[model samples]
Every structure is written in structure tokens, then in C-alpha cells.
Target chain A: MTESVLASWREGPVKQAIVDFVALATTPGPGFVAVADRIATFDNDGTLWVEQPLPPQFDFVFRRWAQEIKQDPSLAEQQPYKAIIARDPAFFAGVATQDPEVVGALLAAFARTWKGTTPEEFDAQVREWLQTVKQPKLGVPYIELVYKPMLELLDLLRAHEFRVFVCSGGGRDFMRVFAEETWGIFKENVIGTAAEYRYADGRIVRAEHALGSLNVGPGKPEHIFAQTGRLPALAGGNADVDIEMLEAARFSVLVSHDDEEREFAYTSGGEASLARAKELGWTVVSMKDDWITVF
Target chain B: MTESVLASWREGPVKQAIVDFVALATTPGPGFVAVADRIATFDNDGTLWVEQPLPPQFDFVFRRWAQEIKQDPSLAEQQPYKAIIARDPAFFAGVATQDPEVVGALLAAFARTWKGTTPEEFDAQVREWLQTVKQPKLGVPYIELVYKPMLELLDLLRAHEFRVFVCSGGGRDFMRVFAEETWGIFKENVIGTAAEYRYADGRIVRAEHALGSLNVGPGKPEHIFAQTGRLPALAGGNADVDIEMLEAARFSVLVSHDDEEREFAYTSGGEASLARAKELGWTVVSMKDDWITVF
Candidate 1:
């Protein structure tokens, strides 16, 4: 047989489930949704790209923080900087999995450090950082590590007329910088944790506090509904932070990073979500067995 | 010769300016913006529909508040309810014109009254209100008051691949109720002042607070950039609250309510915007002189 477009996904129940859901969602019948309501939201980190060792956003922001600390060593005395200086695993883990308190601390640090910068200025910095920094363990640019099977699934959804979006706990502007280029999705399709912005003297400048709560469990659906006036029809995610968003959708697919040989194997913060997925009949994708290729 | 599609607009500089801008934006040249960058935003109240005497959103919410006060006379002691009971013109004017403090009070009242309702419940209430309530002065449904000329302008913009959005100082949910059916734009295209929503027990519910700051003045461009990551290439508005958003665009149009015969004539809240339009050399549409029809 000719190679399936989803060649990276092995011929198994995981791949078949994805194909069947799209068929039912697109077919004209009781299961079919209207074109306007065909919103598909995916979590950014593990859902679409590798989140092992550290989520890409943290690598981006943490490096910026490290650079700022180099310029002014006294800043290293502060909470987040000090936590980084001490190398607190708990703090890092909390943010990686999107714990509200830990992420709130990082958000506060972001607001304080990036205050007074325009969106263009902040975006330039992110672009510059992406060009230079490599994913620590993989030794490649972070954008190069996007999951191949997930990209195929995004293509499949788009072919069926799904308006796909990335709903993540990572910074909204950060993801937006690479959304159109890396994911082949519209730049406006990203909904994530946001910073407060102020407009003055013709430029929209970033403010110190985040716009609202971080885009975690409940915040995901809240931001989705607030922006689009609808919950996602299809949702893909891989962590506890993504549970509520997955639950809110008509279809849920959770990615299990169970391939230690090809990718990191630990669930980290996804144990609860995996259990919940089993409890609820949400489809689970096994990286080790379901995917023939990891990246 | 065939009649122009924008027949509502009389042959004048105002009409020519709009046509010229769209042409330049679509033509492949230095002035030609990519289709992805062709964002057109319009204010909802006076820019899209009739807002004389009182804006329609207040009429909807105020009527509901009035009914609640009747059921519980204690509610009449509250500030917004008390002002409405007393027919306070200053309070109404401040809100219609989008005064930050005055609008903030009304938003606070909304949060207090509507907390714990899901998006579905709030939308149902708004849809029900639209069904029963008619614009008081016009004695017709509020949606019927949308300007024919403005609708023509929206259609022309969309024909040129412009993504038209309604960014209003009104409540987001209130506008979303009829956005798709009345405006022929996606419901997600409506961005307005937002209510904080909390997700719990398999349903996302509204909270007792507005999300972030009120969407007025600078909040307009802030919300636009936050949602779309780009500012408007073209914008239309008719009030002082819209001055900042109008100033941020490449082309700006301000509608002058100078037609008393066909429509109400008033610039109570639009005085500053009209002045800014003159100072900035922005196009000004005389409802009396430019339009062949009022509705």
C-alpha cells in the first residue's frame, strides 16, 4: 500500500482512533460539527513538540533571566532568580507542569523584567534567542524538535476544515513569534498565558503583571471561550495542566512520552492526566509503540 | 453603467477614500499589505449601529437590573441601580461615552449580578433579551439599527480579504449574542470588555470580576494585539474612546452623526474624536452628506 500521510504514526489503534474521529467529525450526520465551530486546540509543549528535560519556553525565558542576572548580579538575590541560582528542582518542575503558584512566580518575574518594552522589542529578543540557543539535551534548535506524528495530525485536522489553535501555559507572545513559521498555523491561533500591555506614544508596551491568570487547567478553557466564543471540538495535550481543556473538548487525545530510547520517558507531571485519560476513555498516544518516528 | 456595490454611500471624498485605501491594501506594491496582515476593526456602538439617546447594551442590562430592583427593592440602593432608578443623565452619558470610572462601576455591578453563570447561561439571557427588547426610540429590534452604509463598507473590506472584527467597549458576551447572525462576522470577531470565567465541575462559569481592564481607550489596541498579535491596518469609530485605536491604524474613519433628518444628530461623546480626525487629517463621513440611506 502507498505510505499513509501519517507515516510516522505506526498502524495501530492510536492512529486509527485519530483517523476515525476526523471522519466522524467531518462526515454529515449527528456527529458532524458546523465549519465555524470546528475549533481544534492543542497544548504546545508535549502535545506538539518535545517537552522532555525542560519545556522550550522555560529554556527561552530562563536563559533571558540568566543574562539579566549577569548584567546585574543583585537581581540574583530575588525569589525566582535566587531559586534559579540555587537550582530548585521543585520550582522548575512546578513551572514545567504549569503549577499556578510556581508559574505565577515566573510570570511576575517576566512582568518585572520585561516592563517598558514594546511588543516589537520583546519579539526581536525572542527571535534573536531562538537563532542562538539549542535545546540542551538534543543539541538542536528547539523548533527543530516538533513531533512529526503531531504535525501529520494537525495536517489531517486542517484538511478536514478544523481551525486549529495552540492553547498552552507558555507565554502567548513567545509562542506567537514562531507559531506561523514553525507550526504552519495562523499567528492569531495561539492562546496562552499573557502579559498586560499598555499603549502609549504610538507603541503598545508590555506591562509588569500578566494579563490574567496563567493558562493552566481551568484557564485554558476560559481563554479559549473568551477569545473564540466556543470550546474546542478537538483537543490534544499531555499533562495535568491540560486536563481541564481536554475534558472540555468533544474529543481528547493525550500524548504519553513513554519512549526512553527515543525521547524522555518520565511522566513528570502527567501521571494524574494519564490516569484520568484511562478513567474517561480519552484516546492515548504511546510514543514508544504508536509512533515509528519521534521527531 | 452598473451601480457601485457601496450604493448607500453618495459619490464623495469619504467613499473614494475608503475605496482607494482598500485598493492600495490589496494591490501588490509597497503599500500592499499581505492578506495575513489585512485586519480591519470597527467600533460597535455608533460605528456599526444606532447609539443615540442610549446605547443598546445598557438598555438590555439596565432593563434586567430594573426588573431585579422591583423584585428586591433593596437592590435599588445599589449605585448603578440607584442611578438608573433616578434617571441619572451624567451616569448614562459617562457609560455611553465609555468613561473609565463610570464604566468600571457598571462592570462591577455586572460581575456582582451575573457571577456563577456559565457562558451558555449568559448567552441565553442575552439572546432572550434580543428577542423581546426593541430599541426604545426606533421601536425596532436593536440589530435592525445597523447602518446600511457601514455594512456595505464591511462587505467591501471582507471582499478584499480583510478580516473584519467588531471591537467594542460593550460587553463581549452581549455582542456575541447576535454577532454571527446580524453582522455576518464570526462570533469570535467580537472583542469587548470581558467577564472573568472560572471552570469547575465540567462547566466553565463566570466569576465576580471583569477580566483585566475595561476595553476602552488604550484597551482597544491592547486587546487587538493580545488577540491577533498585530494592530489594525484600518479602523473605524465614532467616539472619543476610539481615538487611540483610530490613531494606531494606517487609515482611520470617523462617522459624524450630523444627520438629524434620517438619524439622530449628536456628538456628545464623539467631540474629541472628531477634533482628532480633523487634526490628523483622517477621513470623516458625514452621515447627512455621504449616505444615500440611513439604515
Candidate 2:
């Protein structure tokens, strides 16, 4: 017998579903998907990696906001910056709940951090940040916090000729910096929300505003179609923002953050998605029940 | 000796440069790009197919506009639609010159024709159009009108493990319908101008306005970087619209439509690009001199 590709995953329904899907896709059978059509997409923040305490991207942006506030001092008076600097738990809770005003403030700050830099320069800044900063709760670099079982699943999908894509609500260019090294997914396959870019002085530079809709909620399917021109054959996510993306796929997998001891537990933002997964017969993988390892 | 991959291309400086570039990229040596970084972008219209008389996309749109005008004659009074309906040579001349007003009007009309349709429906319509609509001058279906030499070059690039992408000024969703069958490039690999999409009532629908910048001139590199997160390693184009795309690439190839007898001749729009190619020491493949076949 062939050794299991997702050895980190416990042998059960979740692992069985994944293996069965791969077999249906790869083997000579009635429902076999052609190699070109075997596209799989995974949500980045809470799905592929840890998003506990706060999203790693938001942490990165908050640190930059702190630096900006330190320089300008007056920036702390700004609506969002004031809340951020005050360490208001209510403000952080708003972000956790994905409240519109809070989310908009976060996106605005995120956009401003890398606005004028060329892609190369932005990438260098991200690399520098990755080297120096560690996740507050995980006590490791953000990249190292990615789930081991999920990484194995990505490899399993690739070995079966499925073209894997990292679909994220995080910054597109930001994800590209580590996607190739950490995820083994090519930069071209990383689709996410992007700031507008302009060509000036013989190089492309990120503009001050976003190019289009954020790659979350219904926007996920729209962006996916715009970039890849196909609905994913398989999709994975762990949050409400990813519900539409999962629904668009033929097979949907929802990762449940039910492991409090090994990994942080969360049922707040993803409640609706978790409920939908149950109603739709989508596979729900329990981190505590189905996985033996984290990171 | 192995037969040349680009046999349809004449043995000349242009052909030699391509072969040499592929060799350098594929062989283990200094400046050898790994397969992961071997990204090659191509302009669609005249570079890959016959774009003379009118761009095939314009032809597709104009036909739709005519149908729309027939249903509602008042549409014929609209600024651009009026010009298109009259077949005014000056209007076409303005388009050839890329007059901003004329081009904006054209894009607006193009966007409206397929707005509100699902991608699958848009694709089905495009497939139907391809079956019926033949290039006016060439008298062959648009798919078959693709350049034979360019097809050979694409195959050659793929053989060297270069990931080929069609970066076009045409509609992205429109091109995806034919890219797989016509260019042997996958749908995911074709990046082009895109309309905004909305998710409504469980299906993704094309929205009225463009999602971002038009993929022409400086917009090409901006869109390319936005989607792929990398500057193309190699690029090919045939017009001023493609100038910046070619400029952004490590190696640039300009296809000069200097052949009048076999293929339509055009030195008008592409003259500056042709001149820049010479000044920058970029490869210029003459349709008259280099290609033994056009389609």
C-alpha cells in the first residue's frame, strides 16, 4: 500500500475525503478531472496558517502604524490610529468581528504602509520585517506558523497534478514575498487583494489606493474568476470571508480551530461559515480531532 | 541533429536570438533562469495573430453593437456607436491613432455588450462567435488566423519549461474561451483587460465598469505585476500599446508586420516600437523576412 501523503492528518473522514477527492481527480475514472482543470485554492489567513489573537498581516501593519505615529505624533489623533495606539480592546474586538469601519481603517493603514514603494522595494521591506518580527502569541516568525497538515495537503494536491493557488484577503504582494519559499506555491499562483500600481520612472510602483474589491466574502469568487478564469475544483477556508469561495468550489473543506491547547481556538468570525459547511455537507476538519500536529 | 523547434521561423538574427535566449534560460550556466522564474508574456493582437483591418476583438464587439443598434436604433446616435455604425474612416483612424476619447468609447461599448452575463455564458457566446465569425481579410475563423511561427515559438518556450502567458489588450474572459484551444495556453495563464464582476444570487456576473486599468501601454506591466507578482523574464509584442510590456521584460521581441503580400502590412502604429527595438538592441522579427508562414 502507498504511504499516506497527509500523514500529519489523523486517519478519518477529513483525511479520507481529501484522499478520495484526489483519487477521483487523478485516477482513470468517470469523474476524473483533467490536469488542466484540477485547480485548487486555499484561503491564507486563518485557513492555511494561524490567525489567532490577530491576523499576522494586521500585526505587521499595526507595527508600521506605530512607527508612523512615532514619527508624526499627530497621526495618533486620527480615528483608527487613536484606537490602535490606545490599545482599545473594543477596537480590536471590532476588527475581530470584521466591523466595516474597523476593517476599512485597517485596510487604509495597510495600503499606506507600502504605497510609494516599487514591488521590489516592498518585497525587501517584507523580507526585512519577516526576519526581525515574530508572531506575538506563536513566539515564532509568522511564516513558521503555517499548519504542517495543510502544508502536507498542498503537497498532496500538487503530487496529484492539481494546480494549487493561495487565495488570501491579505495583501497580494505581501504574500508573494514568502509564498514561494514557505508554501512552495509560485508567486503567480498567489491571488489576493492588491493596491493599484502605476508605471513611473521606468519601474512599476504601488499606488495609494486598492485596485479593486477586497478578496473576501462574495469578492472571493469574483477575484478568483478574474484571475484564474475558473471556479476552483477544491477550495479550503476557515472564516466567514471564505464562505463564498468554498461554495464556488466543487469540494469545500472548512478547517475548524477547535484545538485550544495545541493551537489557538476560535469560533467567532467563522461561525456562519461553519454552520454553512454543516448545512451544505462540506467537509469540516477539526484541528484537535483530525490533526496530530500544528506548525 | 534535432530539428529546430521554430522551423516556421527563418534562420536569421531574430530566430537566432530566440533560440539563444531559450538556451541560456534552460541550460545550467550564468544568468540561467530556473523553470519557476521562466515567465514569458505575449501581446495578443498582431503579435500572435492578424490584427489588421480591425482588431478581432473590435470586430467581435462591433458585430454585437450592430445587433444592439438594430434592436434599438437610438444606440446608433451614441458618440462611438454613431462612428462605428457609419464606418467613418476618420473614426477608425482615430482608433488606430489611439485617441483617448475614441478608445474610451470603444471600451465602454465593449464592456456593455457582455455585462450581466455569467462567465460561463460569456464563454459560450464567445465560442459560438468563433464558430461563425471569420476574419474579414483572411477569410478564416479567427482561431485559425493565429500566426504559425508564433505558435511554434510558444511550443519551443514550453519545451524549455518556460511558463507562457498571454498578456493582451483584449477582453480576458473573451480570450480564455479560445486560449486553451487556439494558443495551447491554459485559461489561468491568460492575463488581459478585465471587467469588474459582482456576485449576485449565487452566480458571478460581469459588472458594467472595468475592474482596473486597461492593459495597454504602461498599463500592461502594471496589470502583469498585479496578477503574476513578477516582471516578465521575456516579452513579445507588435504595437505601441505593447511598448511598455516589452520594456519591462529582460528580453524583448517585436514582430514587425512588414509583409504585405502574405499578411497585411502595417508600419503606422508600431513604428515607434520598431525604432525603440533598434535603439535598445532588442530582437525584431520581420513577418516578410523571418516567417515562412503566417497561418
Candidate 3:
């Protein structure tokens, strides 16, 4: 039964590339070598999972911000807050491209708001939020909507003795909230953007996270190299920004979204960024032609 | 030959604890718990290496300060600068204990000073310092004076499938400087006190870490629990501060410095601290009885 399931998915060029990668990683030799200690890095938003109107993290954050604004009317006057209050998702996402200064300021505000708590305190709040929050599109728990394929890939890589890491462009603390339970990736291995913390008065205090540019494609590889001092053995992505990270990997796979019937087809939209992974020499896995299942 | 070398060492209760730890970790289980993932945490400084007059890290910091001061004599007139110029090692170590406000103010000053640089830049500077710094007593490079027996134990644990880590009172950044080269322990796994960083001007800017209370013995367990969320299977320590960490481990070992004639016999001047470890029923190993070589 398991062999039939595996064989069912093994019918494309991308599948062949995956087979080759698995073979090299398992085979022991000098030339076709697989470094046992090798790590494989994957991008989160729009790569491993879906990123439509905005990433799920931003959706959660904005929702939290809206709740806070109800308690304090003054935040409505703030620039980014005002943009958010006006329900301008485009303006908020384009804050980096339009006026970069706002990005840093917004990040600082976000960091200051959540700094200096114990792990228990933070985790409890995250758990509470996850229990309460629901995805508008799916009408299900946000955690349930996590890409099933990526979860399987994570398990498969770990089985082969590969250290798989999620090098996301999302907030480190935010990603950490669900990373362990939802993905099985530990907090230490999950690298992302961070807000600062200040310890004082027998308590952990949040410092302003001077946010500016999110760690996108090229920056993903840069951060990984800085933290781990290693280039990944395998890398996966689904967008133009991910090209740099994939190019740096020994084996690269690109998931191309072409199944409109099974999954939402994303080409390029007025608000959303265009996908450009095809030009990066990545083994393109078409949703319709490559993957047997969307999940 | 290896057995003979181990037999030459004095036997102690902690030695047996280590043996038991190795045995339990290697025993196969449902999830494939192997020695490579056993994850043994160790304390650095007095535990793994010599830390007499002051930790070697402080020595480097003081020397660098002096060099910087020589180039700018005006620093002699400044408050902490004047104290630093006085060349009082005791005063320096007691800076926080003596005046809590001074530590906070100094950390603030450092945060402003280091506002825009990559982690790589700081790592490079630390590497340079390690290359130049020599231990006063051993006359060996500070990095080389790491206890030979402990090095073997790390290798043995790794051989048995244990992931060796450092959970110390020292600065996290300091451990990262040499853990990889000296012990094959990656920087991420070595949890310790840390200074916060801020992102500014396209780089990760480090702030001064004003550690109010060091991650001393009991605090060592706190650090490990808070950071990694995994209680170690085994831990080794040299002094009273090691007791808490040792106590938290499934199998704990304390290196008793009873061989005054062979190696420097010393302990942190705190009786109650070690007494607490004894009350916890932890395994204590006499160095004279447990180690064949002092390195």
C-alpha cells in the first residue's frame, strides 16, 4: 500500500529530481557524496505554504492589533496603525517598498509590545490565540490549514538523518509560537526576524524590534550562513525571492502553482507579488503535472 | 588500550553515573533515541576549563578596553572609564554586585556604541582575540587549556549518540567563540547569558548584556530549561554553581578538585551552594579519583 502510494506520485521530472536527491543523500561515496551533517532549509510563506492576501502570520498580527486598538483609540491616529485601521492591506504590505522608514517604526512598535515574558507566558498566549482564531477562507483553525506536503517533507528529511530547518522571513517569535507543535521544528532551529528583549525587575521585558526589510530570498541564505555557517544541501521555494536560496543549495526544487481546480491559482495580482521561480534553474514541480496531491 | 587508559583514572560515584547515562542513552526505543541525539549539557569556565583570577573572556574585554583607552586618554576622566583605568580586577567583577545601576548604565552605553554591525563582524573580532589571548598559569593558549579528560568525555558521549551542549554562566556569545572548534558543540546548542541585538543600518547591532544575576549552578538549569526546553540526560560541572545543573540531569557528575599537588585545587568560595547539591543526592567525582590526565 505504501509502495503504491509512493509510486503514484513518481511520474514527473520533478519527482525524478527528488529521487536523485534522495539517492545521493542515502548513498555513501566520494563523488556522489551525502554529507550526513547536511541541513536543508525551506522558506515558509508562499513557498512551503500558501500566501494569498497576506501571510497567515500577518493576518494573525493584524487581528491582534485590531483588538488592541479597540482598547486604545489613540493608535488609530498612528501611521501604520491608521493604514491598518483603514483596512488597507496593500498599503501595509507595500510599506517597505513605498516608505521603508515605516517598516522599521512598525517593527519597533511590534517588538516593544511583546518583549520580556517567560516562555510559559508567551506560549500560553499563543495557544489561546490559536484556539480562538479561525481562517476566514477555510472556516477552520489556522493551524489546520498548514501545508500537508511540507509536513510530510519535514518528516521524510528527518528520517534520512537530514536536519531540516524553516528559515522564514516571518517574525521569529511569531513563528516560534506554532513552530514546534504545528511543524515539529524546534525553536532553536527556526530562524527568523526578531524583536529585542530587555530583562529587568525579575521579569522579561520587550524591547523595540527595529524592523525594516523582511528576510526574503537572498536574505534567507545570508541569515542561514550567518547563523549556521553552512549552505543547505537541499532548498525549496515557490517564488522569485526564493531563487537565491535555492541556487545556493546542492539540490533545489520549486513548487509551481498551476492547479486552479484543486488549489487556488496564483499568477500575479495587483496586490500580490509575481512568482518567478522558473528562471532560477530549479526543478519546477507543477501543481497539476508534478504533485499527485495538493497537500 | 582505551579501556586501560580509562582504568588508569581514579574511580568515583560520578564516573558510574556517566557510565549509566551512556548505557541508558544507547538503549534502543520507539522513536530511535540514539547517542547522537542524547544531548549532554556541560558548563564551561571552571567546569570544562580553568577560570581562576577571572574568566578569560573578561581578560580579553579588559585588555581591549585598555588598548582603546590608550589611544584615547580622555577616557581616564570618565566615570566607569576612571574605574576601568584603576586596573582593579576585583572592582571590575564586582561592578554589578557593588552597583546595579552601573551595570544597567554601562549596558545602555554599549548598546548605543554598537548600533550597526553583523554578527559575523563580532565573531571575527572574538576569533582574533582567542588567537592572541594566552592563559597566565598554564602558559598555553586559553582555548588549548580545556581539560583533556572532559574532551574525551565529550567524544565518548558523541560516540554513544549524545548531542553535547554547554549550559554555562558565561556569556552566550563568549561560548560561541570557541565551542565549535574546541568541543565540536555548535553555538546554537550552547545556551548561556546573552546580550540583546537590534537591527539597524542593514546589520545586527549588539547591545551590552547587563546580566543582573549570572546563570550560576541552579540558574544553569533554568537557562537550559528556558532555552532548549529539554533537561539533559547528563551534565558535568566543577564547582558549586555546577550543582544545580548537575542536579537537574538524569545522570549528574561533579568534578571534585581534590588533587591539589597535581592540579590547582580550588572552589568557588560558596559553601551553601555545594551543600545544596549534596542534599539533592547528586553524584560527586573526586578529580584525583576520576581523571588520568589534567591537560
Per-model TM-score (chain A alone): 0.94, 0.93, 0.85
Ranking by TM-score: 2, 1, 3
lDDT of 1 by residue, B62-100 (tens): 888988888899988877888999999888778646677
- The sequence of per-residue lDDT tens digits that candidate 2 reaches over residues B75-183 is 8889688998788888877765568888788768867677788888888877888899887777888888899999998999888888899999888888999898888
lDDT against the true structure, per candidate, is: 0.87, 0.86, 0.64
Better of 1 and 3 by DockQ: 1
lDDT of 1 by residue, A1-295 (tens): 2367688999989888888888888889978988888999999998888886778877777888999899999998886898888889877777646677776777778877788988788889899888888877788887888999999889888988898899998889999988987888866789998888888888998888887777988889988988888999999999999999999999999999898888778887899999999999999999999999888
Q: What overall lDDT, based on C-alpha atoms, would model 2 receive against the true structure?
A: 0.86
> CA lDDT of A255 in candidate 2?
94
As for lDDT, the candidate ahead, 2 or 3, is 2
CA lDDT, candidate 1, residue A81: 90
Q: Write the per-residue lDDT of candidate 3 for residues B1-295, one digit (tens) a residue.
A: 2563344355565666666556666776643443323658888876688776567776766676677678888866764566766765554655424356566545544454443545677678788888887887667777877878788788887777677788777777667777777888765577766664443333345545432245664456655554444457788876665666776666676666666765567655435445755787666666676787777
Which regions of candidate 3 deviate over 4 angstroms?
Answer: A1-10, A25-37, A94-100, A108-113, A197-214, A217-219, A240-244, A267-279, B1-40, B52-145, B148-163, B167-188, B191-258, B268-286, B289-295
Q: What is the iRMSD in Å for candidate 1?
A: 1.1
lDDT accuracy of residue B234 in candidate 2: 93
Q: How many backbone clashes does candidate 1 have?
A: 0
Note the residue pairs that clash in candidate 2: none
